[model samples]
Target: MEVISGGFHAVFPMEDGSRVGEARRHAAQLALDCGLDETEAGRLALVVTELGNNLARHAVRGRLLLSPRPALGEVDVIALDEGPGIANLERSLVDGFSTAGTPGTGLGAVRRLARQFDIHSSVPGGTVVLARVGAGPGPQEGHAICVGAVAIAAPGERVCGDGWAFALQGDVAALLVADGLGHGPDAAEAAAAAIEAFMEDPLASPRVLLAHIHQRLRSTRGAAVMLLQADVASGTVRSAGAGNVMARLVSGTSDRALLSQHGTAGIAVRTPEEQCIAWPEHALLVVSTDGIETRWPPTVLAPLLGRDPTLAAAVLVRDHCRGRDDATVAVLRRKD
Candidate 1:
């Protein structure tokens, strides 16, 4: 799906009642945009508010991520918080995990009230509430998903085995893209494993996250990674990466690559160094596995500068991954 031309982001502080109320309003607006009925929208609003409130009462802070489902036709929200990570998944789902244990019904109520609910949480890793509106898991119509583009990791052709993690951490959306060694199954597994490790804390610095992944991947394979965070509101982008993976921050015709002298993702252990640029809301941040490196056309990236990041990235992959190995294109678009 595309971003509302004006750009969409609303910050809500933990435990701040006003912030919770504002988040509910924002959730409602998003629900309406997703074709949700009034009642559905209200329910979604409540779900979001409840989740946000829980964050305030338990985690460092909470963030609400709005994006289009695979089908641009629908909208989805991912409530993010690495706090008070649920100790028990099944028990939490059964409802009543509250520290204060009030009505002990938020989780069950949320499940019964929403159209979709997919939750991922680890006791030490916090929680990410992923929910969708509009439709369920089925073949969505139209070759064109409302988003800009769509693509997948093809077979045969050599491609970078990198997966990316993006979330609004603090003032910027932290992006972590990791590429494993060569291509094929082993590389894919390596990259996937690293992604899981880094995602434990998407906001961690490049070096820290890389080190974490390295130690974890030791049992398996290793990888190379490029981590970047851009604060469009502040017009700044910071990036660091290892291995041969490349990241380009596009500002009009000027194409610049992000480079790091450190080791690879599964092996790095150096001080993180980054380059900062005057990022623009309409600027393009393109990242991919080596399989699809530098193959993106300037034209495709130009119009994608102000669109939904995931959508735009999908389009990039769709167009370039024709005969490639596992390929991933992750784009970050800022709004002015």
Candidate 2:
């Protein structure tokens, strides 16, 4: 099983034609950094070029989210935009079907080059596309559960104050999302400490892990942290949190919000009481920090329920983020 420490390292806003070239260059370099060969990096470059150009030409507001899935030896490219949705999805994939007076091989080529691809779009809402490229095996291989998450720094800030991680131990999985007390370096220190502490013993119960993280953050600025542990054999989920980390369990078309305690980790905290809930079949568990809006409509996530967990994560942040703080959102689900 893979253990992740942070979220997406880069977010390239697709503002204009110039930004497209910049994103393409940076993404190719990211692919190379993941140990991808020249040919693989070149393939990734083309994928980014098509996605970025589409954003510049069609969307009102758009961005390309790039993250390295080191465990899978792949890079994730997710394009998010608020544009007029694809009117005829199936037809648009043909080589000559361009609504913008150019060749329409963008989406088709992305599907062929990427090792994994998934997309969700609506008539009036927007579009979210996921493409994974590199030499790694498919994401679902050798893993019983899949996770997708993203973390980005606040605007004008150099570092993100929020961080997230997950680990697998036998039949159990432990996941965490921590938001340092505020923004900037001090906040990042607290969040990093939280992740380090959690990594020490990931399979511990939620309450125990929360206390451990709290103790470890004592010398830092502190953070609002949430921890969750899911046991596949028992079909149970246990959770505990301090302060404002938000979480939800979605099954079928309904969702339930899990509660957290009223104190910050490290500074002044109570050992948060653990909450246990049944892990319904095919349900999804989502955890996030305060950078995401609390009142985001759960229904907006319906189309993504059966898609890649990372697509769900990216879509949530794309549609609901407050954009003023370091933001993060993670999704977890069992393999079908």
Per-model TM against the reference: 0.52, 0.94
In candidate 2, what are the lDDT values of residues 140-176, reduced to their tens digit? 4565677778888888887889888988655677899
Candidate 2 positional error at 203, Å: 1.5
Candidate 2: worst 10 consecutive residues by lDDT? 1-10
Clashes of each: 10, 0
State residue 89's C-alpha deviation in candidate 2, in Å: 2.3
lDDT of 1 by residue, 1-336 (tens): 112111112334455556777777767666666667666666677777666666666665565545434323345555666565788777877766656756667666777765666565555646666454554333222212111212244454333355555555335667666666766567767877876776677666665765677688776567877777676457777777777666877756677777766576555556656677776545677777665656565666564455455445544543455455555666665443
Predictions in order: lDDT: 0.59, 0.84
